[model samples]
Target: MTSRRPLSFWIKWLLLIALVLGIALGVTRALGKRKATSEAARATAESLQKTPTYTLSSTDVVTVQSIELTQTVALSGSVDALQTAAIKARTAGEIQGLSKREGDPVKAGEVVARIDSTEAQARVRQTARQAESAQAQVAIAKRTFDNNQALVRQGFISSTALDTATANLSSAEATHQAALAALDIARKSLADTTLRSPLTGQISARLVQNGERVAIDTRVFDVVDLTGFELEAAIAPADAVAVKVGQTARLTVEGLSEPVQATVARINPSVQAASRSVLVYLRVPALPGMRQGLFAQGHIVIGGVTALAVPVSAVRNDKPQPYVQVVREGAVVHVPLQPGATGLKGTEPMRAVEGLPAGTQLLRAQAGLIREGTAVRLSAPATVSN
Candidate 1:
């Protein structure tokens, strides 16, 4: 520092110091930028790690339980009267004094219609007069026969004459017997003009009108007993075996607001050839507004038993075999089930399932988004109401 240097030497020394300082400053700035970039990258990575993953919520979960399940078989049919009778004209004549029409209520032995009885009554009277004349002749014949017997014994007349008188008396008695029989026939024919109902029911149809000529065996009316109603349903052979006499049924008619109760009365012994189904007859009580020919559907209770049951909606059949979605350890598990007897769950339908422990949670409805091993959040467990 004390020695004086040349001007060029001094300049060169100052330039070298400037270059060294510039390099040091540039290196410091670069290091600072690198440190900031690394810190920002670390912060972003930590934020991503702290965030939670998305999951699905399961709402239709049902807990499997041991309950009393009533098995049922579904059936359909038309409502029909237990008794239907067709009224026919018994005698051939013009319809007269017609008293009943369609929808008219009738009682047993009530006169429904009357035919013209002018000819019938005249025939009866004529036959009766003839019978009276024949009876007088028979009385005269008896007296003549008695007198002839006394004459033959007293020899007042020849035996041959007595025999001729006996023959005449016999002939007169035969004529009298024939006239009486003819009178009886005419009286019965006259009474046949009046048509009476054999049963107490309502007239369903009136085939003949007043003053219309009809022949014997003509269908004059159709009567149906509405007090006792029955449903005749056809059941498939597979289900027919389960149905039995005395089983209760619930019927739903198109016009009725509530289901009608009925009991299984009988079953046809032979299967129908065309439908390959068995016919089941069910007895129904007379309701306020039930009529004939109303279509109805029903279910017969086959039996009642305790079983591990689930709602029919809960069971799925997407796979080759039927399966159910179960929630286990907060994950969806697909369980294959061996389904058993199908039944009702208090008006709702249910099916019996095996190979699952009681109290296992199952899905009430199928979820398209849920699959095996998928994590789920469970809501409240479903409970069946009585």
Candidate 2:
């Protein structure tokens, strides 16, 4: 009624109204699409919730069986001669000759090497002559004492003179004894010049050569008794408490094809400062071709205990808490477990688990896929090997 004259103005108003109506229709269509999508998703979820689970057969399960779990402590060590002798020169002398060389088999009391015994021999002879002179002096003193005694009884000499003679005889006897002891010492020094092996073994090294002058306590040879071997194994202090004398171990040497058996000979009381381990000495069986200084590794079986366990394949660890799937009364049950040790069972890996009783049926393979309340058929379960 105010200004209906301009047709352009009327067209503009009509356009504006059409644009608003279009926007409203678009928004309504968008809302309808969103509602339809939400309804479809809800329907799909309900259908999935109502779907029946598939049943797994007993063949797909592993029965948790009673197993003998042998606990072992790992050990590493080196091979050594059971008895080793470090030969040294007791007396200083020139190495005139060596009777044995490296790898030479020696016997107890054997002369392995000889020093320059010429000086020693000369000293021994001189000592012997002195000893002989001392003996002569003692004999003469004894004669003088006897003569003085007879003279004193016959009144030929005074009592004081007799006493003087006795005193002289005692002095002579003491001097003779001193000379004899000196001679004995000289003889010992002479014997020491000839180096002798205290034990029967093979010479592992020769430190001195002929014509070489050596001082006292100088190393001459290294002899090792190859008849038997020893293993010095270092074990953790915690496990070493269980180790005792006479406990046996199976050892593997570097070159040996089969494991050698050894008996625990000794155990160190104090822990090693650097390694924080205890030293355990084991005596290895003396077999052919066994040598010293070879590296070895072994295990000490502590004891065996019965435990309910399953193969390692049955345990699933993908979740925050490790668990295993078990089939009970025709339904799958999710069981969270406290797993103990792995690699306890022979060749095949097995796991020690708690919170599960014996005869529990666990899935044989891929237990992670199992869900709670899933249906399962009770068929004959597969036996867990060990």
Candidate 3:
């Protein structure tokens, strides 16, 4: 630079200074843009922190309280008639006079159907005639034996001849006894042609037509008593230990509006091999419009307890630990919970929980999910138990 430079050289130097100045200006503009972006981001975060995330009403909050809870075990099964009978054919023949159909009322000892009695009647007549003939033979044998006895006493006949007469009389008497037995059997067969209802109930099924021939022991009709009902349920082996006879339950049956009451009637001592469950039978009082095979579900009241609890719907499992959304200083806070037994508080399902003090307010399930530290505004503060 000390030496006088050429014009071209000076022009190159000038171009270099211009390029450096442009670079510096571009970097300064870029830094200002970055600082502006950071300030805008910080402002947005502050605004979100100040505004309420959710507005909760009094109904959306539940309060922890000490309550009397009825502990219950869930159960489900089908409603069945207490007494059921399968009317079967006692003798094989063509079915006749089967006027009873499904839903028809039946009385105990009522004739539900009849089998064709032609063969049975004929057998009875033949056996009766044979019985009469045997009776005459028996009378004749007695007379001969009596005569032999008199002759022997008077010495009108030899002792060997009397012995032979005695043998013949014994044989005739045995024959008459056998004939009478056959006649009684024939009469029973004739009586068996008529089928009668074994219980007072309604017919649930009809297996044969009037003209159909059925074999002995073939099922013909199914009868069920609707005056009393029972629910047959299977309980897990672990839970069966607490279930005892006389325990009460409330069941919601299919197609019925009102909940039906039931009492545990019986529990099987053995566990089922297939499902490893114990069978439990609950007796239900007969109600209008109740039917067999109606599906039912309910809970059995095992015991009761007084403890700090909340509604079951308030507990959430979305986090790594089970927690309930609690309101603290106008902000949503997730409090870890140690859930205990589940029960009912005046028909409202409640769950025993720890890690929260009594009278603490918590969000219900209907509030959905709110992030931790989110601001919450309560329109009206109230204590909702369930």
Each prediction's total of clashing residue pairs, residues at least 3 apart in sequence or on different chains, is 0, 0, 0
Per-model CA lDDT versus the true structure: 0.86, 0.82, 0.91
Provide the lowest-lDDT 10-residue window in model 1. Answer: 51-60
**Candidate 3 deviation (Cα RMSD):** 3.3
Models sorted by lDDT, best on top: 3, 1, 2
TM-score of predicted structure 2:
0.73
Tell me the TM-score of model 1.
Answer: 0.74
Question: lDDT per residue, candidate 3, 269-305, as tens digits?
Answer: 9999999999999999899989999999999999999
Best by lDDT: 3
- Which model scores highest in TM-score? 3
The alpha-carbon deviation from the true structure for residue 103 of candidate 3, after best TM-score superposition, in angstroms, is 1.4
lDDT of 1: 0.86
TM-score of each: 0.74, 0.73, 0.90
| Tens digit per residue, CA lDDT, model 1, 229-321 | 999999999999988899999989879999999999999999999999999999988898899998999799998888888888877878899
- Residue pairs clashing in model 1 are none
